[model samples]
Target: MLEKKSEFTIYPITVLQDNIVWVWVHNCNAVVVDPSISEPVEKWLLEKNLSLKAILQTHHHDDHIGGTQKLIKRWPQAKVVASKKELKRIPFQTFSVGDNDVFHLMDSEIKVIEVNGHTNNHIAFYISKEATKYNILFPGDTLFSGGCGRLLEGTPTQMFESLCKLNSLPKSTKIYPAHEYTENNLKWALTLEPTNLSIIERLKLIQNKLQKGMTSLPSTLSEERKTNLFLRAENIDKFTMLRRHKDSWKC
Candidate 1:
């Protein structure tokens, strides 16, 4: 028997206010997730001498799909993968997918998970059983580091169910959420759970990372399970209450 090899490299390109455009590189090909702009991603890919293979869109938000047109013009053959239901919103999609759809990309299997919370047709990509050190999840705006997405289009119950779907994944999954809201979210959590040691310790570590101009995302499932109030909610009602409170709570 031979040992499998890990060949993928995920790069986090922080763009806009809090959005993070994730670039997954394999060999000489690369795939970008939720590009808020084109110049930075185009420049980065050009500098690395990597050709764009695809652009994976998790939702139809302007921030998530803003750079797709420009990026595709630079690499005409590069596939634009987005939600099939978002055709009107994301018109550049060459490969439109739906819930439970599985596709191979960069030598890894990508599973589409429909999570309706921030949006009605939002989806999260999951790559499990990889030879890499950990599994990967590009959860978009659904699940954040210390919190989840705001209930914009979907209801509290919908968001809660969506979170439950994500929480069902393995604890080793490395979450690559779209935004850099971990620090702020954790701060909010601390206010609600001041006595919780896990929240306190996580906040301290996140503060240190911020001080060094670092991102505190890509949180593990285990870490989120322990500290994320949304994920820890026992039922839909509890999740609803927490969401409502967080929505109005100030930092």
Candidate 2:
């Protein structure tokens, strides 16, 4: 579904296979999250006549930060918000934040959540309910619609803990992940629980959305609690087993 433009709206720009560049718009200003490339994002902003406000970098991954430098070049005054620990990797950050650090942006309070799993020092941005109708989470690569990020540089235990941190958020929170992997992740979940009606129904709904060229994202925490296996995992052992299975399993 297309997000309605109100006082503030977040829109998705699909690029580079599954990468999603999320743009948060308020008035004539915009904040982009994890831009994989510059051309399309720049064109979109220019066409909309929106002035770039800042860029939220969830991690230092090349795909996430690749377009940042160019975007900042176009909007020279725009701030680059990223983890303080990733200074070496993401040298462009003008606003460095640490875990639990609260900061204000676009008239809303943003809480930094350090969720190291996809990579060490990986972080997620959490906007409290005071910011919007519902709380918002920009999980970058740490969390997806139906799955958690791969254990690229962090341990399975760390990944499990990271997901737990995300899970602790209010059920009404809307999750905006960096990639469009809901359908594939749900399909993988079905293999483990073929009789699970929640996963079954969610997969069908996500498939319909994808068929219509709509992104199956911005999923609510409540919806994920019911369908996402990683979030449902009770312990590190279960999470590790599922993560390993998913890594080796093919569609």
Candidate 3:
């Protein structure tokens, strides 16, 4: 039912609990990112009559790549793009890529960024096109709206470095993280910095959007710099401290 008139556009399909499967569409072709399941995505693509061009897997987590095999069954020719370092973990990847690797798809340039934190070999996709107004980042679970992913397979140092790399992107870059954790993240930030006007204001706006059943994502990098505490950390110690606090945080 979604319109397909745009030269390029990204749509979010909220699946499972808070996971968001981002579908990037250009003309009649579609590329799904971190599809948690195949039913809804299959239904949506079938309804729009869009051809599945590929599926971008950020990591090997079940919630991220669970539906990939099923989707590939539906679209036999659709390529599975994933980190080359994760071949053992993500065996379905047909187009294996590594850090700094660049490729063209859907008339846009995609740069692979190896951001290991939530999981070793986790990677993010950065999309840029001369025709688009702004760039896009499909950061999977490594970066969120108001927080960063917990250090699971990698160390604090790795996560800190990963966030710095993302922060270096153009401020206008729109972030499409793989989960709908904006509201909860902002609330947690507010608890830490109660007087932060940026956090308070963004929380109100995000709450309103969620109340209306709208996603509070695809947030610009500039907005994240203003409110994401993890991004504001100046050093590894600070970043580590914030991560520990967030892990133990109840709210």
Q: Across residues 26-125, which tens digit of lDDT does each residue of candidate 2 receive?
A: 7788999999999999999998889999999999898999999999999999999999999999999999999999998887789999999899999999
lDDT, candidate 1, 1-251, per-residue tens: 11223577788888888889999887788899999899999999998888899999999889999998999999999999889999988888999999999999887889999999899899999987546655899999999999999988999988999999999999989999999998889889988889999999999999999899888877999999999999999998899989989999988
lDDT of 3 by residue, 105-133 (tens): 98889999999988999999999877766
Superior by TM-score: candidate 2 or candidate 3: 3
When 2 and 3 are scored with lDDT, the better candidate is 3
Off by over 4 Å in 1: 1-6
- Score each candidate by Cα lDDT: 0.90, 0.92, 0.93
Clashing pairs in 1: none
Q: Which of the numbered candidates is closest to the native, going by highest lDDT?
A: 3
Off by over 4 Å in 2: 1-6
TM-scores, all candidates, are 0.96, 0.97, 0.98
Q: Report lDDT (Cα) of residue 187, candidate 3.
A: 90
Best by TM-score: 3
Clashes of each: 0, 0, 0
Which 10 residues in a row give candidate 2 its minimum summed lDDT?
1-10
Q: Using TM-score as the measure, what is the rank order of every candidate, best first?
A: 3, 2, 1
The runs of at least 3 residues in candidate 3 whose Cα sits more than 4 Å from the true structure, single-residue gaps closed, are none
